[model samples]
Target: MEAAWVNILMLILILALIWVWKKFNSLWLTPKRLEKILREQGLRGSPYRFKVGDTKETLKMQMQAMSKPMNLFSNDIGPRVSPYDHYIVNKHGKNSFIWNGQKPRVTLTDPELIKDVFNKIYDFGKPNMGPNIRSLIPGLAMHEGEKWSMHRKIINPAFNLEK
Candidate 1:
């Protein structure tokens, strides 16, 4: 009986250590490693801030921008709608990146580069969004491979020039 209890405790301790390591790796180590890789590749942006990243700063900027009324004569709504993005673009140039929580979002200003990414669908994969956000906005954009093709086929007719 004593030996059995000791074995069970040892198993629990091992499991607990594994869980802790996984949490630490996912929450801190992975993000830091990704940040380092991006920085080394000549991309510039705000440093990763634990789990929250730049979400707090983004929300604050958005709220402040939206508080003011829009200019009737001005067509520049980018600043008002996406204040954080606007600030980032202005501060860090066109090829900069921003942290959306643990994910790093690289902003590409060149039309050709954007086209190339869209063309090579299999080469790049979409980032994993939380369940809450997924539930709120479920659509073709979230899908991949066969599902994406099916969804695109259904929606393509709506975007036809002849229509």
Candidate 2:
């Protein structure tokens, strides 16, 4: 009876340790490693802030931008619609990065770079947003591989100049 009790306790302790290690790796180690890689690649942006990342700053900027009224005649809506992005681009140049929670999003302002990325779609993977955001923005933009290619084929006709 004493030996059985000891074995059960040992198993439970091992399981608990495994769980804790997984949480630590997911929440801290992974993000820190990604951040270092991005910085080494010459990308600059806000440092990762635990699990929240840049959510607080992004929300504040968006709220502040939306609070002000826009000029009806002005064609510049980028600042109003995406204040956080505008602020980041201005502060960090054309090719910079921003943290979307644990994920680092790289901003490509150069037309050629954007074209190259789009051309080699399989080389890059899409960022994983929260469930709420995913629900709001679904379809071709979120798809990958065959699904993306199929969606693009189905929608390509609408953009043709001769159509």
Candidate 3:
């Protein structure tokens, strides 16, 4: 009975250790590594925080920006909807990035880079959405790899001027 209890405790301890390690990597180490990679690539923005990320700051800035009424003639709604993005662009230039939870969202404002990213679709994958959201709109947006290619090929003609 004593040996069985000891074995169970040992197994639990090992599992707990593994879980902690994974959490540490995901919450801290991975974000830092990604930040380093982006910085090296000449992208600049917010530093990687432990857990909360820029969510609070983003919300605050957005609220402050949105409170002000925009000119009716102005077509740019980017400032109202996403003030953090606008601020980052102004502060860090076009090729800046920002933290979206654990993920580092790099802003690609340059036309060349935007075109390149679009052209190489496989290289830039879509972000994972929640199951409820995914179910609500599960069309081509959720697809990847060959499925996305097939979907795009079929859907492209629907919007083409020549069609």
lDDT per residue for candidate 1 within 1-163, as digits (tens), equals 9999999999999999999999999889999999999889887899999999899999999999989999999999999989999999999888789998888899988665665565567887866789888778878757778887787678766544477
Writing each residue's lDDT as its tens digit, candidate 3 over 1-163 gives: 9999999999999999999999999999999999999999999998988887788899999889878989899899888888989999999999999998998888987766865665577778886789889778877768777887788778666554466
State the displacement of the C-alpha of residue 86, model 3, in Å, after optimal TM-score superposition.
0.4
Score each candidate by Cα lDDT.
Answer: 0.85, 0.85, 0.86
- Give the lowest summed-lDDT range of ten residues in model 2: 111-120
Evaluate model 1: give its TM-score.
0.77
Please report, as a residue range, the 10-residue window in candidate 1 with the lowest summed lDDT: 110-119
Top candidate by TM-score: 2
lDDT of 1 at 119: 51
What is the lDDT, from 0 to 100, of the residue 106 in candidate 2? 87
lDDT string, candidate 2, 1-163, tens digits: 9999999999999999999999989888999999999889888888888988888989999999989999999999999999998998999888888888887788987765765676577787676788899889888768778888888778766545477
Q: Note each model's CA RMSD in angstroms.
A: 5.1, 4.5, 4.7
What total of clashing residue pairs does each candidate reach? 0, 0, 0
